[model samples]
Target: MKKAELLRDALIAGNTWCRANPEAITVWVEKVGIETQATGEASFMYSYTIQALATDFPGDVDDLMLPLLGWVWEQQPDLLLNPDSNRKIEFEADIISDDTADFLFRVPVWERVIVTKTGGVVTAEHLSESAMRINSSEWETVFDPASEGNKA
Candidate 1:
């Protein structure tokens, strides 16, 4: 399928997922790579990550999700289960920039990263469900809205 079509389907899947999993905190998608075949047709791969809140959740990263949970506690950002609010939970790439980041502190977090192949093949892998405190500065950046006078 074409790139536009692929993107549309991915968005559709994300929306459907959001609908089915209301508790989902964030649905992040990014194009990871691209390859061209003999026909000159290029197929792009995308990566998606989603997180949520639930004690029953299978995996929790104390160092990452815990701080986010605190931000969510008072801010009550928009999530899968609660999207009616104007507030949004930002998904940032710089949250875990370095390897030692998590070793600094533990913050419970649960997230899943999924990859969509060119043909729409979906795959999920657990990147890190561990508590990471090294990215606290970035975390603050991610949740800056909570602290600023303005609320998004």
Candidate 2:
């Protein structure tokens, strides 16, 4: 999966919806760490930085982060569901000027390749799951509708 590109697109979509100017955002991604095994399994860590430039920056950081968080939720729901998970995403914000600000997010993205051979035939598969699960009580907590005049 193209995590960085998709994340950039998600942020752009969020900014367009909230600020109406997609051009003000620029995203850069770099790999900071990697782990690989002889068994053909590998994990990669990346830092994605988003730079927004405009004379008047509309909305707060939360507004910009909502979409990024949503994307992360889609990619790794376990990160949200299992608080004890060791892979913790980190983010930082730096205000460069009245017109420019930089937001840095460090996240782990991995690709695992599993290969099998039988009868002179070889098959390789990428072992990954992108799923979101919620239990009954958690579902109720998240999906319960708000009453009239009640803010979420």
- Top candidate on lDDT is 2
For candidate 2, the per-residue lDDT at 139 reads: 30
lDDT of 2: 0.54
TM for every model, in the order presented, reads 0.19, 0.56
Predict model 1's lDDT versus the native: 0.33
The ten-residue window of minimal lDDT in model 2 covers: 143-152
Off by over 4 Å in 1: 1-62, 77-81, 95-152
* lDDT (10s digit) by residue, model 2, range 1-152: 35666666777765654246655655554554434565554333332333322223455666666666666656655656776853576776677667555666665555444567789897766555455566443432432233233221
lDDT score, candidate 2, position 41: 43
Candidate 1 residue-wise lDDT at 74 = 29
Top candidate on TM-score is 2
Per-residue alpha-carbon lDDT of candidate 1 for residues 1-152, written as tens digits (9 for 90 to 100): 12222322333343433235434332333333323335543332232323332221223244344444444432222232234532334432222343322212111222333344566775544333233233334444444455443322
